[model samples]
Structures are given as C-alpha cells and as structure tokens.
Target: MTRRTPSTSHRRHQRGVSLFGLLFWAIVVGFFGYLAVVVFPTVNEYFTIKRAVDKIAAEAPATVPEVRAAFERQRAIEYSISSIGSNDLEITKENDRLVIGFAYEKEIPIVGPVYLLLKYEGRSGQ
Candidate 1:
C-alpha cells in the first residue's frame, strides 16, 4: 500500500471553488446594479426638481391671482412628467414658499409596482 504525501492530501482536500459561488455573487451585483440604475435617475430628478422649484419660487408672481397662475404652470410641467409613466411631480404653496413634491415609480425591467415619492420646499419671490 502506498501512502499519500501531505501536499497531495492538502490538494485533494482543497477542492476548486464552485461556479455557483461566482454566479451567486454575480447575480447579487447585477441586482444592485439594476437597482442603482433605476433609482439613481429618480434621485437626480428629485434634485433637479428641487432646484427648479427654487427657481420658480424665486420668480413667482407677487399677487394672489398670479400666484395661482404660477401654480397652474407648475402643474402643467408636473403632469407632463407623469404622462411618461411611473413619475409624477406636484407643487403646492405653503405660507410664503412653494413646496415641490415628486412621486417616482420603481418598475423593474419588466414592470414591478413599487413606488417612491420625494418632496422639496422653496420660497417664491415677492
């Protein structure tokens, strides 16, 4: 009977890593990457909305009727974004500032029904 060397025994015991391990991690990273792709745009849009709201606020009309008209214009822009699909934008006036809110839908590649909403507030120019 021949005895096996320590190195041979170690090599035999140390089996190569399974493809499944690599595949599993790949799946995880792919999922996160997909999520980042989907979510990042919405986040960027939220920031954009914030900046736009500030600009609108800075330029809003001073009178009540004009303020209402300003709101209507804001609504028109919001509805346009909503028409595309899972995104909605809305603006409201509170006290002396206008509050802008965004509703973002998270539909996965095919179409999953998860939604998220983000809001921002800013003051209108007098």
Candidate 2:
C-alpha cells in the first residue's frame, strides 16, 4: 500500500474568493448602484431642460421678454422644469442668432451630511 502526501502546489492552485472579499466587492457594486439610482432623475431633468431650451431657441422670439415668456410657457407644459424658472435663463443674441443658455446646480444626498453636487450647463445649438 502507498500513501500520497498533499502537495503545496495543489493547495496554491485552488483559489476562490473569501467571504470578506465577496462582501467588499458586493458593497462596492451596491454603492455605485445606489449612486446611479439617486443621480438618474437629476440627469433626466437636465436633458429635459436642455430640450426645452433648444426648442425655444430654434423658435427665436422677437425680443428677450418674448423669449423668457416662451420658456415660462414651455415650463408650464413640462412639469420636470422646476429647478430653473424663466428668470434663470440667459438670453443672448450673437451674430443675428438668438442663443438660449442655462446653468444650475443640483445637490443629491448620498448619506447624512454627504451630498453629490452636480453642475449642469448648456446652450441651444447644433
């Protein structure tokens, strides 16, 4: 009868994640997932506002007041534009082209006293 001893090379070849390592990776993935869930709505709102600005700019009302009023009307129609009002829009005329610009900051709470600040800025054009 022959008895074989366990080889150190065989033990080294067998590898898998430990419980602590698994939990660490899980927490990392979960944290990013949570961040994405929190930040998605604000990103959606920014795009919506950008669309509204581009639409208003393409129309290009006669005067600055008219442009502001037009944005107000658009905002009333789109309920997601609560962050910035008509007064917040920067209306400019450059080289016979009417430009609509908007900038705003949004703070998303991740934890107690920890917030993610997002600054969104955009102008109407191609």
Candidate 3:
C-alpha cells in the first residue's frame, strides 16, 4: 500500500482580512462615528425640551396663557433651547389637567452641503 502526502496548495492559501478589507471597515466605523457626533446634540436637545415641558405639565397651570408664560420662563433659563417658543406649543386640558404638546425640527450639518433633519415631538402627560 502507498501513502499520499498532503497537498501544498492547502497550506499556500492565506486567511484573515486583506489591506483593502481593513480600510473599508475603518471607513465604515469612521462614518458611524461622525454620524453620532452630529446627531447626539440634537437628541440631547430634544430631551432637554421634553424635560422642560414635563416640568410645566407638572405645574398644572390653570390657563393656556399661563402655560405659555411658564414655558417662556423655562426657556429663558435654559440657554440650550433656541428652536422652540411659546407659540410652538399645543395646549389643551383633560380631566382638569393641563396637557402640553410640542413638535419641532432640528437641522444638523453632517458635512459640507449635507445636513440631517431630526423631528422631535413631546407631550407633557404620559
């Protein structure tokens, strides 16, 4: 009986990623990182606005005008809020409880001539 040796071709093949594959992955990661950097502030601002609205809702104002005034006061104290105003709010009452609703859009520059538009909506109750 004769025994055959292992083929050299099997050993000659290389494994793992190539230089081009590495570069492509690097670019993909970089793009996501950039997107996060551009998007985080807008999300943060949305939360801040939500908090302010919640605070006003908790106050349970008796009138719509009072709600607007309270929001304006909060906005004045919060320098981060520039995209919203008293007129932007939708005020209503349910079960003798004040409900405030607001919606706004924020445009963030991702790159030259490229922008990301984020839509934010908030309600005081629930």
Q: Evaluate model 1: give its lDDT.
A: 0.53
TM-score pick, better of 1 and 2? 2
lDDT of 3 by residue, 1-126 (tens): 655556623455679999999999999999999989888877887888899999999988888899999999998998888888999999988787788999999888877998888888989867
lDDT (10s digit) by residue, model 2, range 21-117: 9999999999999999998899999999999999989997999899989998989899988899988998888999999999999999889999999
Q: Rate the local accuracy (lDDT) of all candidates.
A: 0.53, 0.90, 0.88
User: What lDDT tens digits, residue by residue, belong to model 1 across residues 1-126?
Assistant: 879898666564556667998899898899778877776765665454455545656775565455446545654666432312212335467776755444444333524665444343323232
Q: List the candidate 2 regions with Cα displacement exceeding 4 Å.
A: 7-10
CA displacement after TM-score superposition, residue 75 of candidate 3 (Å): 1.2
Poorly placed runs, candidate 1 (over 4 Å): 1-4, 7-17, 64-80, 83-126
Residue-level error in angstroms, candidate 1, position 105: 5.9
Q: Is candidate 2 or candidate 3 better by TM-score?
A: 2
TM-score of the candidate numbered 3? 0.86
Q: Which ten residues in a row have the lowest lDDT in candidate 2?
A: 5-14
Best by TM-score: 2
